[model samples]
Target: MVIVGIEPTEQNEVQNHYNLFKLVRAPNLAPNQVAFRIPPNVNKLDIRDYLTHIYQIKVVDVRTMNYAAKRPVRKRDGAMRGKYVSKYKKAIVTLCDNFKYPPIPDKQSLDEYEDRAEITRMNFRRLRGWKPRPQRINMRKKERYEKFNDY
Candidate 1:
């Protein structure tokens, strides 16, 4: 997609990828309700205002949350660590009851997706062979190593 005259630049871009909205599924959310990951500084009211003014959607309610960053934990011993994560904000915006979300693509798009998946499956089968691999013999039961040989 491109605009007639306007060209996007790295610094000139208003916000980073983090500021974009991604559709998500939530068990608790009702129909036509959508979820978006927003900036930590943005509030619920700001979200409502932005949706109404920019997208022209009538926002019924906006719920925002700021999730805490995960603390680092030891992977195996004190020498290694894992699960480094950053804190982020999420907004659940409920559109007006009258609004309807777009319908899922018909048979054509779904057929395309199925074709792509089939191609990927065929590629894997070609490289690995179509037959199922033989089960691995249990090495732990009959231990072969007399000592802890790192090699």
Candidate 2:
């Protein structure tokens, strides 16, 4: 491997590794919006700054979300458990007006993006398979009224 400047050391290597982020492309997402996988502890302001300062990209907004590890189990009795999946964080960055992201040509990266997007779509609450039952309580139907007694 070719070293650019100083010889790479462990401390520098770890710091460099933290700079990694993957670009995710999806048909459902807006053109200006770019999705990427980042470290969980990273905040939105830092992400925005990273793109703008390091990558020279103008960012309008940065939205972040964390995905919990999917630990599968049996539906009937919840006894059988599958392999553990590590949780990860994803960032959806909105770029400045009319700025289009450079197309990623890496086939493997493209495929990974598709898989991540599909997983996210399935995990969405509105379209999820198992939905929580709506509460049928003493809620006002058409008019608002003060509670008469303890609920």
Candidate 3:
């Protein structure tokens, strides 16, 4: 019996692969350069490969900057405490071709996006049994004194 070999296609090569490369808006970036926020563990080679394979874009050069995690500080004593913020990396990829940034959404679209995001946040808080903070009312000094003087 004879067996035939099949070459892996681009789709087959990256089957079920998921990598987070968040596009960052950098107004100061050159037209040929694009910024992305990647995981700290991702290397320059990985970034190049990811962009080339996934986006079908040719990368000329990739520069990476790693940001250390920020430790939480106590509000009163100003001492470090609580959980530390997650570390992240930023990659500035120079492309073979000039890159044009996508157009910003209109006000209505932004409002809708914010509404959806707020709903998701509220759902998450509900799942975590989070309580909403009391709303504060702005008042004059005399009004505030009168309101609190009874207590």
lDDT of 3 by residue, 1-151 (tens): 0001212245725543354677788989999998888778789988787667656789999999999998887777766688887899998999989987766668765646644665676678878998643232223334656977989
Q: Write the per-residue lDDT of candidate 2 for residues 1-151, one digit (tens) a residue.
A: 1112213343332235545576665566787887887667778887876666555678988888999988777777758778777777888888886545564567755646645554565467447665533331124311223543423
RMSD per model, one decimal: 16.1, 20.1, 14.4
The CA-based lDDT of model 2 is what? 0.62
lDDT score, candidate 1 = 0.59
Model 2 TM-score relative to the real fold: 0.50
lDDT of each: 0.59, 0.62, 0.70
Overlapping backbone residue pairs in candidate 1 total 0
Ten residues in sequence with the least summed lDDT for candidate 3: 1-10
* TM-score of every candidate relative to the true structure: 0.49, 0.50, 0.59
Off by over 4 Å in 2: 1-15, 74-81, 97-151
Total backbone collisions, model 2: 0
| Positional deviation of residue 33's Cα in model 2 after best superposition, in angstroms | 0.9
Best TM-score among the predictions, by candidate number? 3
